[model samples]
Target: MKLAKRINSSSVFLVSGGARGVTSECVITLAQQYQCKFILLGRSPIIKIEPEYVKNYFDEYGLKKSIMEYQLSQAQKPTPISVQKIFNQISASREIKNTLSRLRQAGGSAEYFNIDVTDYVSLQAKVTHFSAITGIIHGAGNLADKLIEKKTEQDFEIVYAAKVQGLENLLSCVNIAQLQHIVLFSSTSGFYGNIGQTDYAMANEILNKSAHLIQQKYPNCHVVAINWGPWESGMVTPELKKAFTERNIGIIPVEVGTQMLVKELNSSKATPQVLVTSPVFPPATEFNLELKTYRIRRQLILDENPFLQDHIIAGKPVLPATCAMSWIINTCENIYSGYRLFSCKNFKVLKGIIFDETFVDEYILDIQEKAKDNNIQEVEVFARISSEKSQKVRYHFSGEFKFLREIPSAPLYTLPEEQKDTIPPWKDNNFYQNWVGMLFHGVSFQGMNKFITFSQEKFTAECFWQKIEAKQQGQFPVQWFNPYALDVSTHPLGIWLQHFYQKSALPASFERYEQFAPIPCNEDFYVTTEIKSESDFSTVADFVIFNSQGKVSARLFEVTFIRWFT
Candidate 1:
């Protein structure tokens, strides 16, 4: 299993996303240590040119800026920025050549290919021209970090496709029989879940699963999916590095990470998955992995409820779904020892918990096992609220939570786009709260400032966080969006529903719902809704939250709201 003795000149390593970032560094380090041949594949075009052409080309553009200024002063026209940009690209190509030269000088061989991994036809043609691919190191990924509501369809496609589709394209063209090593880079976000990496986490998790499936097909081949933590790489920008440091998470030095990669490849470990992280990122959460499920009880009171007060609808103070989710999740963290809730799927709210002056409600929070394997345990979380006067529980909620089994290796992705239209900013008076009969006292967090557009089946609105007293910020990293902010996101939908029926409506169930990213309370975002179906007493709809830049940041699916059948 030792890498040094096995890797040789005859061994041709095909590294996708090899021309830049950690992938390039790893390849160069391996080449220096193992002296093996490498075929570097990346999206950047390989700059090929004759030596004489380089000399003449730079001689023209490399003249002193002062000289060019003088030349321009004597002429009618000035040099354009476009010309300088071309020079910059040419300079970049030269750098690539220098990197290749260094690889050769270090007693190793390498060739660069400018190709996109997601393009199957191009990848197949490129790999066919080369000798049999001895190994594959896939490290390509994209980041489109938005709260699920703000994420666009494009954001999800580009981010998810890069890791999933890229791998599929590479695997299809490569000869599985000759493939020796398959190392898929994943992240901790994908392992547990991060605040703003829903698409990324989903994509990387697929990589981990794909590795498992591939190993089944080629059992003898080394197929390792390394869930990497934050390392000193291009993806770890200074801002992110500082954020990690603030949280006491340490960054893995490049040399140390590469060494670990070498160790993983050399070690005779049969486990196809590994996690690499230091103490700083998610912080530590205490839990007993030995105990598979957890059960606890809690109480809800109207007088004591400071956050839920503003959610008054139809003269009744009703609990918001986001608040309910946060309460249940926070309790789980407290009991199980602080594990962050990365995602919640198949979330359903069966009934509304309306507060009455005379009564306090008791609730049960139960965590039941759904699935468990090496690094992750998926649990079904249930919450039931019951009144003291009646034995029957009035409301129920359920969802799934994933605890980390492996570190994640996905990169930070951001999808930013223009708003696409020039519309007047939303004004304060335009919020539906002014017209609605409900008094959102504790729930004022849902106040919206602008209505972008509205249709029978679709709606969009803009909302800003209502300033609260300094003491009310709640816990660090805010478990979810401010309940009121999330509440307001559904306001437009409620307004749309009013036209269909005369009775009051409140969210009754949220099925196939997911919180891909967190909605920051301090920022402004858009809320969009699409109605899926309607019945006599209920309506099912999907909602999304969009950041200011028009990218979806969060999403809800199959959300059903019910009215009393009159």
Candidate 2:
């Protein structure tokens, strides 16, 4: 197969076992993330999404508004009548007119191919026509009682042949011009072997091991395996699904699983593999497991409202001032926006605040291109205004609310910190869109970071910023490196020594501390000074942060194992 000399927009991709469950999610994900031609491989070219299936998903997500937006009509479902309507439309002479019109308006490009992975000849022939493929996501599976029930003799043969044969066939195609990645779907059963699924277990074992084999053979191509655990899908019966995951949440909510899978796939780690999620989860940050050199006194974002000001100021400086809370917050906002729009199936966002080992380089690479294209030095996004004196930007579409880009009609108001006068977007409603602007105090940290003069300046914002960015010339901020993996309680002083230039902090700024108000406890404060276990942080530790004036700043926090109720 031939891929373009370089994999870019002209590349092609395949997702076998798409149109169902996690596989479909992969297809949707790659389609949006990469501009490439897509071929969806499934058992049948005709995706007969049944009404009952649609209804089942709607029932699962029982919110009325969600139901209205996501669920399809009975007519749209792949029922006999629905199928007949689709067929008629395809060949409509008014009789088959509907399908013709539908075909004309399918929006994006998609072609379906029916091929059984077990049928080796058919699989090879299917991919041969394409010169090369940039990527292949093998999410298809015969997860029938995957590990739940004993397998028949046939089950062993069928499961193994499908994944092994299909994968080997693709790899055997030596002439493939360029294949950057080959992602295999290995269930969690592979690692935590399943009792009942002897045959399916073998198939997963093959998938589980295939990544290593591919890496060995083709160093240029990244062979990634995703070990997915229990997920909500047709493969999972309701009772079994519940047993497989934590209570109160649906089986590994499809979106979370999908998001986790994509992140794992994009990672360049050696033989990169990721266990998508866990069955049980902890609620808060517990960072007593660290280098113990420091402790947080307090930490909080500057606020326009005085009450709000004191709200977050109860922790240590878990995040350095050099840390980009704005960037982190904006990343979450972008994630939220994508999920809200188009109900993009695979575009999943985790429900609550939890920081796991996330692969951020992939995300940066994807967004970096956009930033470069837009020449976006720094973008000041005004999300919410909590005060009247804060910057409130408005576009010229107030009269026509719900206008293009869904930009708001009125500026959100908030108090301006740094004490600048809040500028009104526009005093006149009839003003031009360009004329109506919001006050956003933004500075680009992308560059202009090399010269840091710390020899003699007061503790002004500029001085603080220069000290913060002393080491940030070629490198991104420490916060941007991997916020998820950060052990918060370790950085006790917020005194970044690498970036910490001359002692400008009143001669002995590091020499003193006095406890303000000690809350009488069961004498049960689980405290830690530093982290020694870098290897263990990923499996545990929600996050760890040093506090400022003892204010909380990180989602990853500091509580020992005992403080947790469970």
Candidate 3:
């Protein structure tokens, strides 16, 4: 609603991460509904998405194919920094032309600019070139694998440099003329450090600082940060993921997230600094084509490891036959908060951190109503440096929460390690040796030396299939799931096998517990949530944590009784 209103029947937009994830959703939404033209800039070449799927979407909804379809993947070419600098200008120019083309087709057109947002010079050029920049929604940045020992002088410099440059670029350019509005996607990862995401956290902080800069430099523009919980993007190394449990860093369902973003952006009546993310941002008019106001839900997993014995129900409790189901859900919510999320290693990166989910909503709302509000065209996430404010404390650990999913066609409970078997772990392809000792578990699981298939995301079926079909593909080697994480959930045991594909170095989706059912099983809990683009169903999960014991303890949920089908 806010977007529909903010974006007139015709507008022009530039989507940084246009080819994948949330950016893809923004592109599709802008194209389909508002008929906004876009300069969908991605490093990759034109993508060959099965347009049939998109066609089906329109047909299903009685919509039109106004969506200008194209494709882009991260264009890979490790050129010198100088050559990259030149490309930034050239790329920006090319993107502008493309964006303008899209706009003209949308009826009353505009321009688009493509630059390596990770590159500063290009960003400045792009910004200065666009005068009617109404709103900016930034969603571009790199997620570095968190490795303390691996941290090098060059890596550190590269990390902060991009962040510094991007902001400088935006600030310098926006000031060239009056700006309208902006949205920055910060992550919970920056709030805390997960096992292998030191760089990621650092980069995320840069996003926050950029928001501050926008407020400071572009005072007239409505600038805000959408501190996201996590989505399947950015950086996460598989081996490093095993030690964390919160998994909130990149666990947002793309569809729901996009909708929330649309709603928040649309509800210009209110402006917020940050929002934890929920269905209801009720301070303004609610124009949802979907149902219900909002809710957050969780399933309590009871552990029998005696390690969780203390979390058991306090008293003898009632007999299994006459137990109240409501009590079970209520108990489960508490248990989930305490044990699973608060202390879960997967999400330790976000522990002990503070953020204002409400702030984001409120801030956006305030900005919408203020006289300073202007039309925003695009937003960007840039690289940044670590601030020296809280340096001394080595934050190896923190706190968290968990939200578990119910298996559809709900079945009986199984043991924690009881998952089906899958392909065993393979040797680390690159000589990095971090995963060297990991084959031990793989040998146990698959009984042989397994061949690797991938390492750092970016491979897709069309890309990898050709590799598999190649005889000389030996030199074009691939690593199987990282010893750290894997998506092989079909195996009785949900193994953490991970290989990069589509998103990043991490397995885009962790195949936890066979399969996951969509949220809202017991409708009384979650109001519901999916769609921005093909990336609509993409997901990452956040666990709300609570502590019940010395270890990461959550209240374990149990089903004491159920109603008869009669």
- Over 83-142, each residue of candidate 3 has an lDDT whose tens digit, in order, gives 444344333344444444544554544333445666666666565555655665666655
| Poorly placed runs, candidate 2 (over 4 Å) | 1-7, 45-108, 146-150, 173-177, 246-250, 265-271, 279-566
What TM-score would every model get versus the actual structure? 0.48, 0.41, 0.37
Q: Judged by TM-score relative to the true structure, which candidate is superior, 1 or 3? A: 1
Cα displacement (angstroms), candidate 1, residue 268, comes to 0.6
- What would the per-residue lDDT of candidate 1 be over residues 1-566, giving only the tens digit for each residue? 32222556667888887767777777777877888888877766645763332444455455334334545666735466644644555665765676678778767898888888888888898889876678889988888778899999999998898899999988888788778888898887678776667999999999999888988878778888988888777477666666566556677788988888888887776567788886433544433445465656667655556555556655676777777777666665554443445556667776556665534556666676555443343333444433444554454566665544222332232333334253333344444554363223343465665556656666676677665653443321145334556666777665565544544467766765445455646678777788898888788898877676555556778888886432
Per-candidate clash tally:
40, 60, 101
Candidate 3 lDDT: 0.34
The local lDDT score (0 to 100) that residue 349 gets in candidate 1 is 72
- In candidate 2, clashing pairs total 60
How accurate locally, in lDDT, is each candidate?
0.67, 0.38, 0.34
User: How big is the positional error of residue 22 in model 1, measured in Å on the Cα after superposition?
Assistant: 1.1
User: lDDT, candidate 3, residue 406?
Assistant: 19
| Clash tally for model 1 | 40
